[model samples]
Every structure is written in C-alpha cells, then in structure tokens.
Target: MQKIGFSGTLDPITNGHMWVIGEARSIAEEVVVFLSENSTKAPKFSAEERKAIVLASCAERGWNNVAVQIVKSEYTARVAKRNGVGYLIRGIRSTADFDYENLIQQTNVEVIGGAKTLFVMPPRDLGSVSSSFVKALEGPVGWNWTMKKFVPAPAYKAWILAWLRKEWDSLWRERPHSAEWFERLTGEQAYGGAERHYHNLDHLVHGLAEIRAWAANTGAAPAHVALVKAAFWFHDAVYAHAAGEVSNEEASARLWLGSGLEPDAVRAEEVATLIRATDHFQGGAMLHPLKDTMLSVDLAILGQEAEVYQAYATGIRAEYAHVPEADYNSKRAQILAHLRGKAEAGTLFADPFFTDNYTAAAIANMSAELALIAGR
Candidate 1:
C-alpha cells in the first residue's frame, strides 16, 4: 500500500475515476496515475492537456499524495514494476465489470507477476460514470447539472466555461457580435452577476436542456426549438437588476429584440412573450402551447426531486437575502401559497409534459416549504 498505480487514457478525468483514486489514496501513501498513451487511441484531449487537467483537479481537492506518469507505448505491469508500485487499482461497477476486471486481476497477479490489481467500485450513484459518458454530455440538453455531478471541479470549471463559449458562438454564428457583447451577456453584468446564486449561466444551461428535452418529446421543429432557446437565453439574462423602469423580463426581451437572432420582429415578440412568462407575479396567462411550454420549463424545478427543489429554494432565498427577513418571508409565503393553491387545483404546470412529471412532487415540496415558513 506504500505505492499504488491507476492507469487509463483519461482523455479527461471524471468524478467516478476520482472515486477510485480516493480508494487508492485511502490505503496507499502515494497514488501514481499512469496516463497511458496508446498509439491507436484517438483521445479527445492530448496527453499533456489531460495531465494538466488531472493535476489541477488534484489541486482543487487538495489531494497532495497523487502523482502522474505519462506512459508512452508501455504495458501497465511494466510501468508498475518500474515505479515500484505493487498494487494497481481497478474499478468494478457491475457483474460484467467484475467478470472482466477479475480476469485481469488474476492475470496481473498470477500470470504477469509485476503488479496485483485491487478492485474497487464506486457507490451505486456513481457506478455508471465513465469518460465516454462525460464526453457525451458536452452539447446536449439537460446535462450541465448532470455533468457537474460527474466531472471533477477543475474539469467542470473548464467544461462549463468552454460550453459557454461554444454556446454563444453558436448563438451568434449567423449574426456576429463583438467580444464585448459576448462578455456583457455571459459575464457579471448579466447572468454571472455577483448577486446571483441561482439564475446564472448554469441555470440558463439547465433551462435550455429542459426545453430541448421538451422539443424531443413534442417533436417540435428546429425553428420552434431555436425560438424557445432564444427566449431561454434572454429570459433571465437581465435578472433582478432592472434599469429602474422596465421589469427584468422586459429588459431581457429588449436585448433580444435588438439582437437579430430572429429576423422577424413577430417571432422576436414571441420570444419576448415567452420571456415575460418567467415573472411569477404577473398573473396574465400567455395561453399558447409554446408560451406555456416556456412557462412550465421556467418553473420546472418546482417539480424536481426534494434535493433539487431544496437547492432551488435555497438559491432563491439567498438571492433575496437583502430584503428584510420578515418582508422576504411574507412575500415568499404569498408566492408559495399561490403555488400551493395552484398545485391543489391541478394547474401548477401548463405543459402536460411537466404536469405529468412534476405535479405531485412540486406540490409536496411547496407544502413542506410553506409549513417551514409559517412556523418561522
């Protein structure tokens, strides 16, 4: 257990890989990660880039006992022998993994003679995570939160920043914007404000994911999906810090209106209308499927699991912490009660998609939260 080896291409390291590393770290004095370079492998990230990322991830977690060795065209056992590492850590998440890894372990110890393979499995929640899975979440809908859970902190940071750049580049592909506009939109003045604990870029990413999921379910055309996505981008971009006269939604919509994402002013207006639906207090119903879809998606967090709901509520409370507690509690109670009432009336979600998935859970979360506020 003095020295141990963990080997993989690790095109990019993931949380699950970190789990196994933690296991090796627990027993070993030093854990050396063998970042293998196979001639035939076409990895997403180069070896040097992956090594820096892995080292940064270790730094992020304050894991000082870990080290890395770039293995070029060498066998794992030979590397282990060269490094004087007696044990190699292998992850087994399933019966198939066990069957495969067990064979390898036997071969390494009995047949190969240089290293003994120690098998470890992550907790069931992390059982399925792999680099391939993490890589696949890059451009997809509904993956920012999911990807955050799977990737290490440093890699996640790199990933989200990269994703933001790619997203904006795609947004402005047809209609180009200055570097300053991109910064203004994605940086602190907009969604990335210091005051924003929630409603930030990640939230926008989640909303985009949800809408695309909605599109896939409803078989929405590319145009409609694009319109809804535009609405999502500008919906919370001007959150809370309104310029005195206009509401946040109006401010955000005005930005969209000026931007030529959609040449048609009418469609731009539709995006605006959809953005306006995010204002929970404005009781007027927009009453179109697309609008309702936007509304449902905007509030979709309400219908998520208790943990996600709690996180959402906590973020909302954090954002409104400047308000006097009594006033904040009172105002929040009213909104929660209104939602509770809506839930009881089976009108909590406008889209049947969300209505079916989130209705009961949303009601339950609101009711529990309301009880806490009342008691407080």
Candidate 2:
C-alpha cells in the first residue's frame, strides 16, 4: 500500500502504540498517525501535545515516512479515504481487543471507497502495555527505570515532566501562589536543576506515594495527610548542587515557609520543622510521629529493592559529579557508615512501621553500597 493510517487518541503514546505504528510503516510506503479526539472522556494530553509526542518518537526512530495529523471527526472510514490512506491500521492485544476492533474493521471496509482495516499485534511481552498502564507507574519508587522500558526515548522525559506538572497542580489546586511556587521549585536552580539526579521532583512523587500508602494503612486524619504531602513536596525544594555546603534542608524549609500558601504561624513553623527533618544528620532528637513518618519515608529508598537502591546510589553520585572520585567515595562511605551505625543502634527509622519493615533492608543496602564504595 502507498499509505496506511494509524488512528487513536494516544494520550501519552506507549511502546504498544509504537509497535502498531511500526507495523503500519512496514506494510506501507507512508504512514499517517491520526490523533482523534474522544469527547466521552478527557485525555491527559491535548491533540497537539500528543501529536508532538508521536512526532518526537517518529523522529527518534528516524521514520521519515511517518506523519501525524489531528482528526476532528470520529468516523474513521471517510477520514482515511480522504487522506489517501489505503488501510487503517489497528492493534489487537488479545481476543477481547479483537472482538472490539473487528466491528470497527467491518464498518470501515463496508464504507464505499473507504480504507481497509489492518490489524496488527505487538510482541507478547507488550500485550499488556497500554497508555493507562504506563501512566500508573508515574509515582512509585524506581518508576523512571520501569517506565523507560515501555516508553519511547523521546517521550520518557516528557512524560515525567507532564506527570510532575499534574501532581504539582493537584497538590496546590486549592492553595494560593501555586503557579509561582511550582515554578520556583521546578526551575533550573531548584529541585528541577540538572544536578538534581536523585533529589528531583520524581523523588517527591515517590515520597508522596509513601505518605498516601502510610495514610491508607493507618487511617490518618486528612489534615496530617495534607501536611505530610506538602512537606514532602517541598522537602528537597532547594537542593544546592554541592552537597553539605549550606543546609539544603534549612533553605528548602525557608522556601516552604515563604511559599505563600498562607498557612498560619503554627502550621508554617511545623512544616518548616518537618522539612528540616530530612537532614538526617541533624535529626535524631526528633520524636514526633509525623516527623518520624517523614524521616522514614525520605529514607525509604534505602530499603527499596536491590536494583532500585543501586540506582538511587548512582544518582546521588551523579549529582556530586564536581567532586573527585576518591573524595566523593570517601565522603559517601563516611555517610553510609554513619547511617549504618544508626541502623545498628536500632534508631535508623523512627516510625514503628518502617522500623519493622525497612530498617534491616536499609542496613543491608547501605552496607552493600558501602562495601562497593570502599572497594573502589
């Protein structure tokens, strides 16, 4: 065929969608990605945004034969025919998907002078990879690594930024100065700074997930939940590129205090204190439950699966790229040794839940990392 059309809403465009596009490209000299609008449900990205993501992926793949266009009408046959598309390509992941798409295939083929339907299936491993499935991985720890496997190269970072925007918007939907506050936190000089490999907004997403998960289990009050969420959001808001110069926790706490949310004096001070608790070295004296929860969640990466912990350690190293390897490794080993001492003393995690679940894993992870650092 001279031309084939691949049509869908493609809210964020996953690898599964790309597989179908590849199939279309293989069968036709040219492929048109028809980004259609669905009025029944709102999409995460607009037509133009989705088109941009698709185009980026196409460019990344060096697909000169592919093009993207927004389609206004829901009817696929007339649109495909008008575009000179000889076939409309669709992806079938399972019998259920085939059942749904077969009806559309019949409709298109029945239309006078309309394009024929071409059904393609991705690899079995990608059968379950959908836009929604990829979207669900946005907040959990080590999500970036997992998401990278499913998203196209060009869309991975874009997806993270969009997810962060949504999360930041949701966090401050009812609050004042949201726009200004979010900009500062995500700007190049702050959490979104290029140096923030480990302490970036994605880290906040993981922390927020931990908070919500804790709340879900403990039935914590909404106020406490809100406080902790906000604290987590702004905890690393002002990470300086160099570690242990000025207190990043103190600066971030100040940023949170003056963030224009208009919290009363007590609330503001309490939040500042909560933010400061992230500075693990200055934190042993803290005995409050909320404080304990914040500290534990912030350190929870140490207890994540082995691969995730290794990634976290590598990111931390990347952030301190200015330092010489020997000095960096020496300082890192010192910090790990300090934390290991705390873990051995049975005071590494304060929250009883984390103390029981994460303390041992955290110790093991840190010790392993420490050994690696020493060997180097």
Candidate 3:
C-alpha cells in the first residue's frame, strides 16, 4: 500500500484541505495529514487541538484511510521518510501557491532521494478558502452561519470551544487572585506531577469551562460558582495512580482545607464535601447543589464523543501503567458499570443541565467501554 504525506499547520481545516485530501486518497492507499508547526509563524490553535480537529473531521467524513498526526520536526522530507510515506502532497490554488510549493518540492527531493511531491489544485469553488481566511472570521461576533460553510462541522465546533476557552482564560487573568490563582496552583499540581495522564490540567480546565458555562446560563449565585470552581481545582489534586491504595478525593480535600486558600471554615468544609462527592464509589444523594454540580462535572467525560472518550480511556490506562492489565480492566469495568447504572436511572446528575444534555450519551459510552473491557 502506497502512503502519502500531507503537511500543513491546518490551524482550522477548511474545505480546500478536504478537497486535497480526497485527491490524495485517490492516488495513495493511505494518507496521513501532518499537523506541522512553524516557529516563524504563529498558530491559531495548538498542535494537539489541530490534530483532534483533523481527526474529528476525518471521522465525520468517514475517511477511514486518513490519519492525523502531530509533526515535531520542520523537515518535511525527513518526516515523510520516517513515516514510510513515499509521496508528499500539496495543494496549489494559484500561480503564487505553485511558485511557493515548487521551491519546497525541489528541496524535499534533494533531502529524501526517492520521495516525490505532488501538487493538487482544488476546484474553483474551494480554491479561495484558506486557513488564514477562516482564522480572520474567528471572534465572538464573526462566527456566524456564513462562516460555517468554509469549515468542517467537527473542526468548527472544536475551534469555537478553543476560542471560548481562550476568552475565559483571559478573563480570569485579569483577576489574578481568584480564578487565575486557582488555575496556576492546580495547573502545577496536575500537569507537573509524574503520575498524571488523564486527570491532568487539561481535564481540570475542561471541567472549569463546563461549570462556568452552566453557571452563566442558569444564573447561578457568585458564591455557588466560586465553590464549584474550587472543587474542580482540588477534586483530583492528589491523584492516586494505584488502585485501592488510598482515596485521592479525601487527600485532595484535606490538602485544600489545610492550604488556607479558603480560610473560612464553613466554605472550606463545603469545598471539601464537594470534592468527596466526586468519589463515585460512595454512591448516595448529594447533600447540596454545589456537590451535585461537582459530581456531574467530574463524570462529564462519559458524555464526550467516541474519539475523545477513547482518548480519555487511553490516558487513564497510561496513568495506571503500574497495574496489571487484567486487574486494571476489572477495576475500571466496576466503576464504569456503577456510573452506567446511575446514567440509566436518569440520576447521574442532579442538575438539569447535565441530565438533559449528557445522560443518554454518558450511558451509551459507559456501556461501550464495559463491553470493550469484557471482550479484552
């Protein structure tokens, strides 16, 4: 099977790139889109986000033979050769594009003796669409119905969420003592730790974003919002990598109480209670609204799309690398089965926001994972 390489920043993949990928598919048995980063040029999205967008786009289009990857090196020819790609594909929309790509093609040929570069010109309708053009339309007011035509649905959704996250981060930066302080402290504990993979800074950020959105829409009280945010930060602060050794939730809550981040004894106790609610092992009714919200947010990963959920599962396995596979799968299945039961009962989340939007998907994802583990 012949493998073809397509390299670009793909900041936000456009219809033009899809057209070129289709053309590459016709010529090569397998196609890999390399989400390359250039030091001289600033990217609108991170490399990981770009790769996810590409993968999601491919999944939506049913492009089974196309794979998306992040390229660490700027040397295109060497990357292609290392990936077993025999040909490199580039799209040319005009004379300028042709002129620019021709120079790179010549250099690539010299770098990899036997590799080839193929130029594809998109159809007239898509020729004008580019990443730069899509990026220009990115803003709170610019992403309208018309802008949707140029980008794939999955990519557009990912880009919008990423943009929203950036805005939220900026807003928190302005108030460094509150949201930003928790962000920095939790970020260090989660991302800098050696045993973290799934329950890391990114996971906390996602949880915070979800809670913020829900709080905004529901007109939640400022105090309630603050409490939930604190829970999100400390829920997994002391992630226990091994199974059944100690309760991470308890340790995290104790750490939060002693840190003096929240000196008020009453609110500090509330935050600790919310963090313990995330321990799905102790199944029971939530004692308060804040605890309910925190529990739902912690289980939100169950409702993500299949690809994203699969990645979450993979990260979790990586975190428990010390555990034997059979034992790990057994423990994981038990937890998922418990969640699945709650999901099926329509009581997974006390909040209407999560119950209405995520209940069905969460149940389905948990069932799927349980089956996979059983089969293995």
Which one is best on TM-score?
A: 2
Superposition TM-score, candidate 2 onto the true structure: 0.86
Ranking by TM-score: 2, 1, 3
Q: Any runs in candidate 3 off by more than 4 Å, and if so which?
A: 1-188, 192-194, 242-246, 280-286
Q: Residue 119 in candidate 1 has what lDDT? A: 84
Number of backbone-clashing residue pairs for each candidate, in the order shown: 1, 0, 0
Q: List RMSD in Å for every model shown.
A: 4.2, 3.1, 10.6
Clash tally for model 2 = 0
Give the local distance difference test score of model 1.
0.81
lDDT of 2 by residue, 263-292 (tens): 588877777778887775665554445898
Q: Rate the local accuracy (lDDT) of all candidates.
A: 0.81, 0.81, 0.76
| lDDT (C-alpha) at residue 122 in model 2 | 85
- Return the lDDT, model 2, position 86: 73
C-alpha TM-score for every candidate: 0.77, 0.86, 0.56
- Over 2-21, each residue of candidate 1 has an lDDT whose tens digit, in order, gives 89999898867998889899
Error of 2 at 283 (Å): 4.1
- Clashing residue pairs, candidate 2? none
